[model samples]
Target: LMDVARLNGPPEAWHLGFMLGPRINAGGRIGRADLGVRLLLESDVSEAARIAAELDRLNSERRIIEQHAEAQAEAEALASLGLEDKGAVIVTASEGWHPGVVGLVASRLKEKFARPAFAIALEPGGIGTGSGRSIPGVDLGKAVRHAVEQGLLIKGGGHAMAAGVTLRKERLAEFRAYLESALAADVAEARHVNEILIDGAISARAATPELVATLNRAGPFGSGNPEPIVALPSHQLVDADEVGQAHLKLRFKSGDGATVNAIAFRSVGQKLGNALVQHRGQVLHVAGTLTVDRYQGVERVQLRVLDVAVPDHGPAMIR
Candidate 1:
C-alpha cells in the first residue's frame, strides 16, 4: 500500500487517518467485516498485499456509494430547511440508501450545514437504521438516549460526536423534532461563536514541508488538541478544479510568485466550493492546516483547506 501511494518516509497522522484508515474501515463499511483484521494479522507479505489491494478497492466502492447517498441526503435537508436553512438539526431518510454509508452522509451534512445531522436508511420492513454526526457543544448521544427513553427510537446510543439509532419508520418525524428541540439552544450558541481559531498567518512562500513537520511535533492532534490552522492572507486563487468525487483541488499564489497546492475535501456544491469557483483569480483569505504530501517519491507542502473569505477592503489581515 505504501508503494502504491509512493510513500517513502514515515507515515504522518494525516496519512494514517485519510489514507490508510479509510481503506481499513471500508471493509466493515461495505465489505467483509473481518477483512481489515485479517490483513493486519497476516504474516505473509504477499498475502497482506492482496488483502490491502482488496481493501483499497472496497474503499473506492464505498466512496461511490457514500457520494450518492450524501447527494440525496443533502437535497432532502435542503428541502426540509428551505433557502433559509433555519433548522438546528438536519434529518434525512430514504428507502434505498445503503446503511453502511449513512453515517458518512450524516457527517457530510453536518459539515455542510454546520448543524447536527442524521441520515436514516429505511428498510422494507418499516424499520429505519440511522447514523448521526454532531457539532461541538451538542451532546448528540444524550439526545439520542433521551429519544430512546421516550419511545421515539427502538434503540440508540453513541458518544458526543457520533451516534447510531434504530427506529420505526413512522417515528422519524418525532425523532427529528425531539432532537431539534433538545439541541436547538446548544446548536445556536455553538454557531453564534463558530470561529476558526487560526494559530498564525503565513505566505505561500513560507509554508514548507519542514515547517509542517515541525508543527506536527505538537503530536497527534485531534478533538481536544486540534492541528494548527494557519492563514494565507491575500493569496490569489490561481486554479480551482473539482477532483475525486466532491473535493476541490486548488492552487494559490502569494504576491512574491510562490505557489502552494491545496485541497478542500468534500466541498463541491457547498458554500465554500461555490465561493472558490466563483471567485477564481481573485485574492482571498484562506485558512487551513499544512501537511507534507508525498507523491511519486517527491515531498511537497499542501494545505488542507478549512475555510476561506473575501477581503472587505484591501487584502484581509489575519487579525
Candidate 2:
C-alpha cells in the first residue's frame, strides 16, 4: 500500500492519519465493511495488493461523496445559524445524504464552525443515522449518553471528541435543543480558551528537514500530544494558490532570501485563505508545524499552516 501511494520514508503519524488511515477506513465508510480486515488478514502478497487497490478506489469515491455532502451540510448550517453563527452546536440533516459520509461532514462542520456539530442522514421512514464531532472541553459523549437515557436518541455513544447516533427525524429538533442547552457552557469555555500556543520562532533557512527530524524525536503527535507549532515572524508571502479540495498552497520568503513551501488544508473560502490571498507580497507572521515531505525520493520541509497574523511594525526576528 505504501509503494502504491508512492509513500517513501519511515511512516510518521501524519502518514498514518492522512494517507493510510483514510484508505483503511474507506472500506467501512463507503464500501464493503470487511474489506479492510480481509486485506489485513490475507497472507498472499498479490491478493493484498488487489485489496489495497480496491480500497484506494473506494477512498477516492468517498472523497467525492464527502465533498458533495459537506457542501449541503454547510449550507444547512449557515441557514440555521444565520450570519451571526450564534450557536453552540450545528445540526444538519438531509434525506439525500449518505450515512457513510455523515461523520466526515460532521468533522468538517466542527472545524469550520469551531464548535461541536452533527450531520444526519434521514431515511425514507424518517429514521436517521448521524455522526458528530466535538471541540475540546465539550464532552459530547456524556451528553449523548444523557440523551439516550432521556429517550431523545434511539442509541448513541462515543468519546469526548466524537460520537454516532440513531434517531427519528421527528426528534432531531429536541436532540439539537438538548445538546445546545447541555453543552453551551462547556463549548463557550472551550472556544474562549482556544488559542494557538506557539513553541518558538524560526526562519525559512532554519526550518530544515534535519530540524524537523530532531523535533519529532518527541515521538508521535496526536490528540493528547500535539505537534509543536512555531512561528515565522515577518515573512513575506511569495505566492498563494488554491489547490486540491479547496486547500491553499503557499510559498513564504524570509528576510535572508530563504524560502519555504507551506499549505493550509481546507482553507479556501475561509478567513485564513482569504487573508493570505489578499495580502500576497505582504510580510506577515505565520505559525504552523513542520513536516518532512518526501516526493520522488527527495525530502523537503513543508509547513502545515495553522494561523497567520499581520505583523506590527518591527524588525524581523529569526531564531
Candidate lDDT values, in order: 0.85, 0.85
lDDT tens digits, residue span 114-142, model 2: 88999999999999999999987888988
Candidate 1, position 55, lDDT: 96
lDDT of 1 by residue, 241-285 (tens): 875447777899999999998888778888888889988999999
The local lDDT score (0 to 100) that residue 259 gets in candidate 2 is 93
- Quote the lDDT for 273 in model 2: 85
What candidate 2 gets wrong by more than 4 Å, as runs, is: 1-28, 33-68, 313-319
Report each candidate's C-alpha RMSD, comma-separated, in the order given: 4.9, 5.2
Q: Where is model 2 poorest over a 10-residue stretch in terms of lDDT? A: 2-11
